[model samples]
Target: MESEELLGNLGQEENGVPKKEKKSPLISLEKDLTFYADSIKEVAVEIMMEGISLHPIFIAHQHEVSIGEVILNKADLNTDWTIQASTLEEFIQKGIIHPDKKEQFLKTYKKPENYMCVFVVVPQGANFVYYPYPKEK
Candidate 1:
């Protein structure tokens, strides 16, 4: 019996190794999404069971959180971040950050040290990474 293939043309060879894939825009998205979709159930289950860990950095920063916040998004710097949300709302509500720049600031909410990065879950079913604060002098 012949096996059916799921995508693109038949895999080709190059220099004795299988060639890399060339994806169309839609195919590119589907490939990425299909991979995640395979894990979505597991992720949902894990979130439901063990749940996510969070730190309350805002509690201490209180009325002065202009410095912003960060969280670890990858196992190491060599990898891209799995997530990178921010404390724009929290900071604004606390009067540490301004509301006008919320969208701009959130766009650049960066990831922190791999060892120190951890994410905070917002009420909107998203994440905002929270990293260990700098040590006081």
Candidate 2:
């Protein structure tokens, strides 16, 4: 299928309104590094189990001072992973990611009002790690 067609499908909803996906409990104001990391891993494993070879992208959005949200997007499922991965690596090297809780930072980066930090989950041996995309100036 063409990329455009696939994107169109993603935007489609049964009724005009988009269906709400189950939000991950890991998104919150309190810091939980292990929980966030495990959540990302679970998402990747779930995708793999579904027979989807694409790597999942988890975009974090912080809508308020204390509230944050996470939305999962599949990078390889819709686009080229090589190009995306390279870009993300640059961001990580530049320190776009949070110093400690890298995955948790996503909650604030992809906010609905102001998008910032973006990251892609890359396979590292038997685990997954977040590779951030640089925030636009």
**Candidate that scores best on TM-score:** 2
* TM-score result, candidate 1: 0.22
**Residue 96 CA error for candidate 2 (Å)?**
17
Which residue pairs in candidate 1 collide?
Answer: 72-117
Predicted candidate 2, C-alpha RMSD:
16.2
lDDT of each: 0.32, 0.32
User: Per-residue lDDT tens digits of candidate 1, residues 13-128?
Assistant: 56679766554333332333233332323332333355331212221110111223322223432222232223334456644446786677555554322112223222112223
Poorest 10 consecutive residues by lDDT, candidate 2: 60-69
TM-score of each: 0.22, 0.26
Q: Tens digits of per-residue lDDT for model 2 on 1-137?
A: 23222123233355788656645433431133222444445554554466543333343322111111233222322422211111233334444433565556445333222211223222111112333222335
